[model samples]
Target: MPNTGTPPLPDTPDNWPVPPPPRQEPDQPEPRPGPNPGPETPDDGVPDVDGPADLPPNPPRVA
Candidate 1:
């Protein structure tokens, strides 16, 4: 076959041109905390309930 003038394909992976590294995005600033944040505390104005303690105790089961 006659040569087409184009360079022959690389036989090994090492012969190929290395690709450019991926672009990196700029770092974002952390958010600032407001007056009140996170979970609510008992002293946050609303009264706290007794929860499970308010329920009646279970009776013992006989064999």
Candidate 2:
């Protein structure tokens, strides 16, 4: 059997083909206002795992 060798890489990264651009989104409609209760409600005093005390002042809001 004859010897086989690996293919050589391009001289520079620029020689690589660029990836396709990200998908575009259509214009979105204005957001509607959410519900609002008439009067101020009292808190139930339940502990929040990721609330003010638990998280840093400028905590990241990730999904």
Candidate 3:
């Protein structure tokens, strides 16, 4: 029991390093287009966004 010989693999170049260039979805910061983007209408104009009686009757038991 003595012939240990099986360790040498680093030639990876067929399609290995090419798969890491497709993850470019991280440049997202261009979202500010509209008459209201978000949160801005509480002068009785009503935009509190709750409706359904404000939805808080009973939703706390998270044990």
Task: Give all TM-scores, in the order shown.
Answer: 0.28, 0.28, 0.18
Candidate 1, residues 1-63: lDDT per residue as tens digits? 898999987789887889999977659866775554345444444443432333335689888
lDDT of 2 at 63: 95
Model 3 alpha-carbon drift over 4 Å, by segment? 1-4, 10-12, 15-18, 24-29, 33-63
Report the C-alpha lDDT of model 2 over 1-63, residue by residue, as the tens digit. 554686667689887889999988769976887665444334445434333233334667899
Candidate that beats the other on lDDT, 1 or 2, i.e. the better one: 1
Query: For candidate 3, lDDT tens digit of each residue in 1-63?
Result: 565796656787863455555556657786875554365434464335443223335777899
Worst 10 residues of 1 by lDDT: 47-56
Q: Which ten residues in a row have the lowest lDDT in candidate 2?
A: 47-56
Q: What are the lDDT figures for the candidates, one per model?
A: 0.60, 0.58, 0.53
- The CA-based lDDT of model 2 is what? 0.58
TM-score of model 3 (CA atoms) = 0.18
In the order shown, the candidates' Cα RMSDs to the true structure are 11.6, 17.9, 12.6
Q: Which candidate comes out best when scored by TM-score? A: 2
Return the top candidate by lDDT: 1
Q: Model 2, residue 37: what's the lDDT?
A: 42
Pick by lDDT: 2 or 3, better one: 2
